[model samples]
Target: MQDRDDAITPGWVADLAEIGELVSGAYGHYVERMEMLPGPMRTDYAVPLAAGQIEVLRADGRIAGLLVLVPEPEHMLLDNVAVAPWAQGRGFGRRLMDHAEARARAAGYDRITLYTHVTMVENIEIYLRRGYVETHRAEVNGLHRVYMAKRLG
Candidate 1:
């Protein structure tokens, strides 16, 4: 991990669980698969946050988004990104994504990779617009996933 502790605000750590709630509807299609996933791992970014493996974005003095990045030998894995529904379409998602790209670049990583559920077509389109190309598709943990990546300049 990149030790993102200093990059995220302190108070926001406690609100990640709350932030996780923002994506509940987006994950509605995965009710069954979600159950297949271990309890805490289901939309919980606690592990990554505590490990300094991700960053959180706040808006109006509150937690509005989260970016989960896992350090890999070849690239930074964009494990997850979620923006509060109320904060959606307000540029928060792009801001966090841009930050993730910069973070990856600064870490000497040439790429950033991520995956979204196939059912979440909107997310797939958003990532595509951000320049992430689909690398392949896979079914993991009972969920159909589309893997994507962006090469950093």
Candidate 2:
């Protein structure tokens, strides 16, 4: 990771886009089955990072993962966690969750929340193992959403 806390740069966005594409499979099946908006593949990630809320996770001295977060009135929203497809299964996701929890605590939030498609069963298990409890499940705009939250100290 870079040693700076500034907003994401254009170069950073490009790097994230590449990783987003490579890691799009995490949501590919759900997106296809539900015809979800944006279709699981992304080229534009600037909207989420526009407020300088995105962070990068590095691997092999290169940009390989992203953690997109947004601070709300009561908690921090873990908007996205993407690890390069090439870099998955190497414990990067767990590390990213740890990073998110640490950052949320530093921001004075006791709770952090995130959501994933219902069909992303593996993701749900991972979150549960990370101490996130299932808050609810809903279908919106033809997409099934499974929401989860973790309370931090």
Candidate 3:
């Protein structure tokens, strides 16, 4: 996995457009499916980019996806993850999640937490299959979300 902190460069500012495109392309279709913009679709990645929390995945020398991981006192938060629409079905999303869990473990974290919109049942199922358990459900920021966590062994 690329060290997000070490990977930042002056070029990152220029790459924002490509990063935004990947994120939007990944989540844009959900806007209609969910009847509102999905959280990722509305996000401005500059915040996370500036915080050194955004990790990029590349394929064929092109940005194929991104992952945002935030370390909390108690757990590492897998804040956001997305693969470009054209890049889906290539296992990039799974690889990114694995990187998040590995990073959490390397960072001395025993647990990792994440949430998805309640309307994204597929994501919830994928998390479940990967050993994440539903911790709770709540409405946050005008979105009904389902939170989940996994214990690192």
TM-score of each: 0.80, 0.80, 0.90
Which candidate leads the pack in lDDT?
3
How far is each candidate from the true structure, as Cα RMSD in Å? 4.8, 4.0, 3.6
Residues 1-153, candidate 3: write the lDDT tens digits: 333432222226556899889978887877887898888877888998888888887775667778888889999999998888887898888888888899999999999999999989889999999999999999977889999999999
- Best by TM-score, which number? 3
Candidate 2 residue runs with Cα over 4 Å from true position? 1-11, 14-16, 23-26, 29-43
Instruction: Give the range of the ten consecutive residues with the poorest summed lDDT in model 3.
Output: 2-11
Candidate 2's error at 85, in angstroms? 1.4
Scanning candidate 1 in windows of ten residues, the lowest lDDT window is 2-11
Model 2 TM-score, 2 decimals: 0.80
